[model samples]
Target: MSAGSRVELYAAIRRDARAGMSGRELQRRHGVGWRTVQAALASAWPAQRAPYPPRASKLDPFKPVIDQILVVDLDTPRKQRHTITRIFNRLCAEHGMTDVSYPVVRAYVAQRRPEIRTEHGRTESAAFVPQTHLPGREAEVDFGEISVRLRGELVTLHLFSLRMSYSGKAVHRVSATGGQEAFFEGHVHAFKVLGGVPAGRIRYDNLKAAVAQVIGFSRQRVETDRWVAFRSHFNVDAFYCQPGISGAHEKGGVEGDIGRFRRNHLVPVPEVDSLRELNEFIDDYDRADDDRRIGHRVHTVGEAFAAERQLLKPLPVEPFETGLWMTPRVDRFAQITVRSNRCSVPSRFIGRQVRVLLHASDLAVYDGRTPVASHERLLTKGACRLELDHYLEALIRKPGALPGATALEQARAAGAFTTVHDAWWAAACKAHGDADGTRALVEVLLLHRHTPHEHVIAGITAALRAGALTADAVALEARRAAEPIDSAVPEADGHTAILTPDAAVVASLTHRRLTHLPADTRPPPTVTAYDQLLRQTTS
Candidate 1:
């Protein structure tokens, strides 16, 4: 029985004994033995049970063997370490301990493994001190993995996140890779989005972008030179957590922020056409997150940020350039290789040196001081980015190359060579031969440099409807579509010298801009009498 149950029984027995009830009668009433009733009546508290003496078990004889095996396992790799099942089998096979059951051997090994680890100097469970953060004093930065649908394909992207220590306000952006360049770019974008850098230190784990190596158990670090320069440029100090698992608590806010955001915003796995579009969605999510409150806080995150923003260090005058610059020679194919991926530039720049600036998600090529081409940077190695416009001149020269060119295929994929353009090309091909038609299409594409795309498309549609297969007809229609509505007159009441009836109607329409003129108070001029006098003179 439990001590409480025994105590209650004893109290009841004492009460019944005081009332002159016999011991046999008390045992019958309480459903207890006569001896138990007598003992309960005599003692005030419940009787204590005696301790049992030690007894031998089937596992006792095999304990030493189990301990020895575990000791040997300490030196071996963890995967090859001794399991309870292995120990049981060894006891039955090698030691000839048939009487020892699996459960007995398994239970003993479970209790002894911790002792083995303790002897080998493994650390015990971890504990952390709680912290209080000052407003705008610090922030924690980390990168998390996320899956997004980019250009109709599912891709895993690295989400760079920063959380303020006090306000719980955060900013997140998606990067193509978690490389050093992306790390730097994430910071630059975060600082700009937050409006300033934290005056106090920012906490980080030993991410390779920042730390080159950790020095011993002291938690000191050897930071990368680029990281040092980046921090110095921003005039902010950094605090790195201990090298590994021990440092997780140091930046716990951002660690939790990443999870909270993923659960709330990224659960549906955002679908977007480009990385730019995905980042824009993230930007919107960050803005919407301002309405949320941190635990037990009186104000919303946005409210807290308003007060904390003033305490932050002012932003630098010029934005930090967040990309790598390289000089690459345009090859015979009019392409420059960046990170083993090919992106085309203008054919004019072929066989010439060009400056390439590779950013986190895009790249731009410059010829001397002029930008020659820009393309979304391809993260995949050996992938190519070709523009049809880049090869148009060459295609015009070698008309046979127009149909099967890589640039032509890319143009179709990018929607630059639209169905309307295709329809116009087919009609032209039927009117003129294939080579002449392709040359004509290339000529029309060159006009896109000077004319708006929608205007040209509209013109193409009009010419197609009119059965005009010539590029000149399409250009005329497109130019007409692009022309602005004539809302006002250019000349000041000086034109329109002839006052015919149609001219009078136009003059009436012009009255809106010519409101300063007096109303026509005099009688209308007699042009009919003048016409009759001219008729008599002619007769």
Candidate 2:
């Protein structure tokens, strides 16, 4: 019977006894035993049950062997340690204890293994202690691997998360790499997002980006020089936890935050065209998370953060340069190698050393402060990112190479080189042989630097319709495309001059008045009148 039912029965029996009823009569009325009636009458409650005597198990004889194995296993690697089956088999083979079942050994080992570990100081719970953080003083940083579909290509990206301990406010950024550049950039972004830096200390693991080497088993770590400089610049105080699994719990808040954010926002595997766009989405989600309450806290995350924001240390006035700097020699391919991936520069950079600033998602190449080229960071090793505009000079000279060039293929894939270009190229080739036609197209491609893309496309279309395959003709048409259709210039010399408003689009103004002038049909300005004068003179 349940405790409530027993208590109710006891109360009913007491009430009947209060009316002077006999114990046997109470038992018959309540449908309980005489002993229960007596006990209920004696104390008005159920008596505590008696304890049973200790009993022996079938595996009691092998208890010593199991203890010995477990004791030894405390020092052994986890994978190489003995299992319950191993213990049972060992007992049967060596101790000749046959009749013992696997369950008997399993129960004893399961109960005893943890006791052995605790006796040897191996349990993690023994070291766990609840911690309270001062507002805006403590934070945790962690990086997790997240997957996303970028432009229909599935890629794994590194997510850097910084979570405030007091308010549970977090700032997250996705990076193409988990390197130091990204590490520094994440810090910068997080600080700006939070509006300040932690005043006391931020907790972290022994990531290679920060910690160079952990000294012995203590908290002292030899930090990387760049990390040291970064800390100095931002006035940051870093507190590293113990190494390995033991250290994971030190920053457990951010660890849990990573999993939570990924599940709540990234579970469906977001598709994006670029990292910048993906980060913007992340920023929105992070702000939305502020409305959520953490655990049973009285205030929401945003409410708590409002109070903590004032306590945080002020940000530095000067921004730190987070991009990594490298000097790479441009190879024969007119590309420079960065972390095994290659990015193209202008062909003039070939055989020359160029300074490159490599960031988390892109890189900019410079020739002594003059920015030569820049590209989105390549994710795959040994993969090349090229721009067709970079090799225009060489490709024009060798038009045959254009068809097979990697740059052209990349341009077509990027939609920078369109079908109109192809159609125009085909017509140009048919009109003026293959070599000359490609050169004309190259000249048209060069016009992009001077004219807007829409104007250039208009020019190409107009040139094709007018059957003008030359680059000069395309330039003139492109300039015309940029002008207003309703606009007209002053009529001069029996010709209408349609001048381009933007003189830089072309060399000189073009005249269209001559075409609009009426043809002379009166006498064709014939010399018959002059012929009559000559006849009279001859007479």
Query: What are the TM-scores, per candidate, against the unseen true structure?
Result: 0.75, 0.80
Question: What is the lDDT for 504 in model 1?
Answer: 22
The reply for model 2, stretches above 4 Å from the true place, is 42-127, 487-539
Candidate 1 residue runs with Cα over 4 Å from true position? 1-30, 33-126, 212-222, 295-300, 303-307, 483-539
CA RMSD per model (angstroms)? 8.9, 9.9
The clash number for model 1 is 0
Candidate 1 lDDT? 0.86
lDDT of 1 by residue, 1-539 (tens): 89898899899989989999998899899999978987886787977889898788977877898889988987899799877888888888998998877878777788888988897787476777688889989999999999988877888889999899999999998988787778899899889988899989899999998899989877689989888888888987889888667688889899999999999999898888999888898999999999998889899999999999999998888767778889999899999898989999889888999998888788888877788899987767899999888988888888888888999888888888899999999998988999999888888888899999999999999999999888898897888779643444445656634334323223344554477677779987768988999999999
Worst 10 residues of 2 by lDDT: 502-511
Itemize residue pairs with steric clashes in candidate 1: none
Which 10 residues in a row give candidate 1 its minimum summed lDDT?
A: 498-507
TM-score of 2: 0.80
Per-model tally of clashing residue pairs: 0, 2
- Point to the candidate with the largest lDDT: 2
- List lDDT for all candidates, in order: 0.86, 0.90
What are the per-residue Cα lDDT tens digits for candidate 2 across 1-539?
Answer: 88788889999999999999998899889898988988898886777667898598778888998999999998899899998888888999999998878887888899999998889988876466799988989999999999999989999999999999999999999989998988999999999999999988999999999999999999999999999999999999999998998779889999999999999999899999999999999999999999999999999999999999999999999989999999999999898999999888999878999999999988999999999898988777899899999999998889998888999999999888999899899999999999999999999999987799889999999899889988998898898789655335445466766656553322223345565578867855578799999999999
